[model samples]
Target: MENKKERYQVALVSEDQKINEDINFFLEDRFHIDVFSNGVVLYNHLTKEPDKYDFILSVSGLTGVHGLPLKETIHKLGFSHIPFFLVVDKADNDMIQICIQNGITDIFIKPLDKITLQTRLDFQLKHPVVGWKKRKQEDKGFNSYKMPFVKRVFDLLVAGTVLLILSPLFLIVALLIKLESKGPVVYYSYRVGTGYNIFKFYKFRSMFTGADAKLHQLKHLNQYSTEKQEPSDLEPERQEVKELCEFCEQAGGGCLRPLYDDNQIVCEKIFNARKKSDKESAFIKIKDDPRVTKVGKFIRNTSIDELPQLWNVIKGDMSLVGNRPLPLYEAEKITTDKYSLRFLGPAGITGLWQVEKRGRGEMSEEERLSLDNDYVKNFSVWFDLKILLRTIPALFQSENV
Candidate 1:
């Protein structure tokens, strides 16, 4: 006696009922298809029963909790074993790059080609993703593209030429820095770069001597610090406030009773928490910081402080165009595989984000990280050249130091 073959389980997420029906009709013979209208429902179902589906096919532009973000969520939740594909009406190069970065298995364009779709689906099903080999190949290719012999020659030539031409300016800046502040003319910090490689990054000193010692005193002025609120009696009815007060009392912690009427119990608490951990903000910046010397302000605003980094490029610690390297503190926070993708390319003096958002102060931290990831995914030699050209104009823009 022969046994019946079991159908492969697939979860389909799309808002359009007709499209869902068509996909079901095509795949039902080989797959036990489950349909979902939005990402939220699909996510909930997957969370409850992660092993229920062997594959996920979602529309790119679903209304509540869109496909790309949901894919990221799934990846973050360690659901990389199941293959995920996106069906899109249209997708640009940037969108495609983002999809690839998020580990999307494949993208199917709408006005669906039934035959091609079936062929692709069948191929992917037969060849399940085995290990990290594919992802490593992609990273290896990106890293190779970023550090070709030609690029190395370009970096050496450009950095050498720039350093030679700017020697007089460097001397003048060093003199100014020495005359104004009692410290070394150049600043060096340990920075993490490609492959999480640690190297000493150079820059002209842009703050006062012993400025680091005063960081604790000026932490309140840190632009990136998570804001904390002093609890008050007005919010006493809130359960969180009550619980905090109870915790404080039991822990023998200080209370904000002095500021409240009738000596009501109140406990200070952090509010509007930062999305990133404190360690991730190792490179803190403050606008109009008091720690900067007179010469420091001028050099930083005009980007003269960045000149010494040409030496770093010459030493092969950085490139002319790539993602900015992070400080060790910040690098430690990106230990996860997905976030670590930013390290697949060489570190740079000026990169995609710096050129794209020049003089734009409203960019969020997540947006900056996304730009770095995008650069790692899409960068080529020509792309690097374009970024370098764009950076020349951006130098005069009013960007942060």
Candidate 2:
């Protein structure tokens, strides 16, 4: 028998009694478990006895104390070093990404299986980032998505089937992108993935070549507002960009009668438009970001532009379903433990974030972060496929995919 000192001390912050009981059943065999129904009681207990557990698992949508906000307060009070494994039952891609970046050590979905639960706990005990991943493989009961190897087969099958069916459309898109844009058809980018690993993400180029070079000049959008702001350059830019959008009505060719006077009329209108557009609107979004080109807008709306990421899934850089990958700057917004939990899975192509609260022309860093946490806590393969299936409907609604 292993020494009790070597055993992991885990604090499960879950409101659901069945889940708590189930977790205890699987964990009792290998861990010294202390479970609580909510964050307040657990937090108070921690205050009373400062260092009892080796790791902490914080569940999103808990009773009384909400998920991400609770994490922010906990980190603020300087209990940050204690590992926090986040739990989510309902969340989107962006929310999960923020969680991993914040500091969440790990994440688990509800109705966790016996083996998976043990695997995660044991892994964490020896390799605890936040909670423990149990090393010893012991199964005393029914598995949720039982058969680890079978799960892998399903993932491959789904990935393969999607790839085969979408091949023609993928080709057509590639050609159209090449024909429409001067740059490469598929824009490959170095993005961070699970374990902070860097992987190349593919997307239909929505911006012109040297687009990144222009980001510095276009950062002017960030100059808007920030009472609801954090310490991020990206925050300011979002507002600034949204502020700059009044001209979009004109840019998108919306709400204006076309005049055939001359090119000078176009230029004059464009100039006047930019100046007048610099105002706060009811719907915090820039309708016509001067940055997006005609092709860019179309690509964004049709959702065709995002299709290239399927290749990322094929290559195993990402999963068919999981949290969205963070573009370096976006990842920095998360500054708490609950944030890191989002990064636990292989980054995904279409995620809970996009299907639920997509860029919709106006989503905040905080809102995205919260949703990411929720997704992480509630991740599952079945859930992933279901989200992917529902995603097709959203493509029609998307301005740019």
Candidate 3:
């Protein structure tokens, strides 16, 4: 069967009809364009189908509900992963900075010539909203350094290489895990990785065989770290999620809800354990987790368990260097502002602060923000190399590496 051509829908909202039409006329050859007189109308469509378009273009200087308002609204919607462009005059530096701070797609300046708009548009299409999409396209493969590439390539390469060279140590650990526990050899976790997609992360099984099932039972103890306690809505959508074993155990699919769809063959949801946080958006770690097995502690502490992610790098599930991939629970924080731009690129094995302050855990989300932002702004292949070298000695001092 022939595959359907991918659809690329775009929105352009501007006060000037001439400019709007010009953009439309120019873009028609390339995309499915939707023109709006202002941000209001465009926002309406977006709200209806948050993922409706491939891109959104909001021009500056709308008298009421300016560009910033529309962008913030999208941010609130938490669909900040969608690619969006800002149209403005070059003199609008303040607005540009605000857009940058919020992680808006690059800008399109006023009096935008066909060449520039097309160029910027090309870049957006080139860098899709997620990793799976990027790898699917013909963009250049991974670079160990730079902006276009994720920031932690250096860390990944360094760590992955070391692990491969020290495979015998991992073998010893594997044997110890077997000697110490009666369980599966590896712990396969369905974690939310780069692109917010779930992947089975491999680690020498550090926890007990059924640790996950006991998490709820341990909730009271785990809840002690209120600072780490996720917001109310962060848990699995239990009403919606079909528990694997329970579902299989039930005679009639465990009695579904009113909104159940007969057509959704499985109708099972794996609501990620890591729900994106709803706060200022700076949590990427699962702290002092009770689900961690005794063997898990040694691997996690020595940072030996992350070796499996090297497969992610080879398979392009992640980059060697970039922002560390946060679980969905960590998403809201990055998208919210603490490190908004940090989410713009791929998740990494090690990144800016990972080599520097990740070990001490001394840096606040803000400090991490500064380092990540600097990486994005000044990213390059060589820069990745420098970070890679800086990471060598620092790995001993850090837990993230």
Number of clashing pairs per prediction, in order: 0, 49, 22
Task: Quote the positional error of residue 197 for candidate 2 in Å.
Answer: 1.7
Q: What tens-digit string does per-residue lDDT give for candidate 1 at 257-346? A: 211111232233321132244222433556688888898888887778888889989999899888888865466445445566787788
Model 3 residue 346 distance off true place after TM-score fit, in angstroms: 2.9
Candidate ordering by TM-score (highest first): 1, 2, 3
Question: lDDT by residue for model 3 over 293-318, one digit each (tens)?
Answer: 67778777766677767777766666
Instruction: Estimate TM-scores for all models.
Output: 0.53, 0.47, 0.45
Regions of model 2 farther than 4 Å from truth: 1-151, 220-287, 359-361, 398-401
Instruction: Using lDDT, give the best candidate's number.
Output: 1
Off by over 4 Å in 3: 1-164, 190-200, 210-291, 398-401
TM-score of 1: 0.53
- Locate the minimum summed-lDDT window of 10 residues in model 1: 257-266
Q: How close is candidate 2 to the true structure, as a TM-score?
A: 0.47
lDDT of each: 0.70, 0.58, 0.57
